[model samples]
Target: MTELPRDRVRELLDAVLDDEASDRDDMARRVYISPFHFSRQFRLGTYESPVALRRRVILERAAWRLRRGDSVTDVALSEGYESVEGFSRAFSRAFGFPPSAAERTSTHWLPAPNGIHFHPPTSLWVDSAEAPRSSMDPTTQMVHHDIDDTRYLLELAGKVAVRDYDRPLLPRHVVLGWDGPEESIAAVLEHLIWSKEVWLASIDGADVPARGGRDIGALAARHETAAPRFISAVQRIAAEDRWGDVLIDALCDPPESFVLGSVISHVLTFSAYRRQVVRQMLRNVGVEADQGDPIMWLRTRHQPSHER
Candidate 1:
């Protein structure tokens, strides 16, 4: 099979998440490839057909919604299934449990293929290969680690009470960069996401979107979208041996240029600091936030069976 470009594959994956690539022809058109070639390349890269991948993603999302207390009928319709019975059957077959059992059981419903994995609340990620430590490059590993840590932090944020999420955590005059005295836990989280967006746009040579006004749930969704894109962008840069290259920020009046490595380091450092602030804010509001330590999260996620 011919190799498919990773960036194009990322575009197709995003289209899948947006429910805009259901048709093979449409996906091929989006990538400027023929349908046959697109299918061949997709299967070669992901080990699943586009249709199968979409179905699995939708089902995974349905399972997540069910666990989150969405009614079965609503999930069914939202996923485009004709009826609850059909959705239940598909859900049962994919997860080995009927939709009714989702709320009561915490389980990984299906094994993701080699390259692709499901991230909760409706996201699919194309991860690095599962190779021995010596085989993977340092940059790729670091990117994966950051992505995992961010996901863990989002999970912790999900536990914050809605009332506490937007409550002021600092006086209005005390500002952190763009955040001001009206800063709440939500504002801090939003800034964290906004920073990521701006850095990613710089990397991609795209314009940054306007920031703020997103709730906690919307921020989580943005993280889900941004994390994978950032990973793919970093990996592409690493593949091209361009981490040391300078990216000029035309949006800046002085037109500042930053070394790609410095930009990445800044993002990682700022994300850690902001996450800690959010955790502290959650604690002050009586929510039992996790320690938000990446090492602990890694250990729990990849622990040996003997240790367990």
Candidate 2:
């Protein structure tokens, strides 16, 4: 499966903030996705339109500066808003008041590591989580781990893949290459989003299609390609606004030679490594990860969950 166009995602963000790539048609073409499809997918994946997401990102950065007492005009320019009025309108829309109001207030609202917070008083509003940026509160580590569990449905797709096909074939396990360690594929994918569900928990991400996927079985009976199925899982994650954005951000401007196999290996290794880290990080706090199906360590050294 292929990921979405990273440059297009960047362009949409920049367009929203700076009009750097203001051509709507170009925006649509860059993702190789239609504007409507693109907009819908962007909203589903990011919980905001390309434009709105960009604005929020801008506001977040601007808010950081505002908290430091950067002037409205300066904040606007920093955010790439053409004029102060333009920046104010967008900022007001995001925060429910103008920058002037923000300046007047002693406390401002925003998310902190484990919770939401307001300045001046520093009141806490939420609990700490694994993926705070995505607002996901999970006990499992965001780092990668070996996984042996497979969705019964995904296995069904794999069975269909070997047969005669007029359609596509999906796999229960997201297979990238027989050449590399299976761990690598899982790791690379996890590094993209840092979601703990798939690699660290018994639960899988919402992006995993339901037991009965989008009529994918029929495709499995057809041309018989697993790539389509894997792509669907990634896109489902992307469209659902999950921590997939973390993955998206990681790839938005990735290094030129992102060795797919080696990276996946690292990602999977991290899961086991992180569980060790989590054990240490939480031991003092009394939040321990009981060894079980998801977290199967062999001896003092880490082992792949597949063997468990």
Q: What is each predicted model's overall lDDT from 0 to 1?
A: 0.67, 0.38
Minimum summed lDDT over a 10-residue window in model 1 is located at: 127-136
Q: Residues 1-308, candidate 2, lDDT per residue (tens digit)?
A: 99875543344444444435454455566656677555544432322335433444456667656877889989898667899999888778557688877756544543222222222221223333311233222222221113211121222223332232112112232333422222222222222223222222112223432121223333222111222123223334434545323232232235123333333345445545533332332333333434423433222113221221
The reply for model 1, stretches above 4 Å from the true place, is: 1-114, 117-142, 172-182, 210-212, 304-308
Best by TM-score: 1
Kindly give the number of clashing pairs for every candidate.
1, 20
RMSD of each: 16.0, 20.3
lDDT of 2 at 250: 30
RMSD of 2: 20.3
Q: Can you tell me which runs of candidate 2 are displaced by over 4 Å? A: 1-19, 101-308
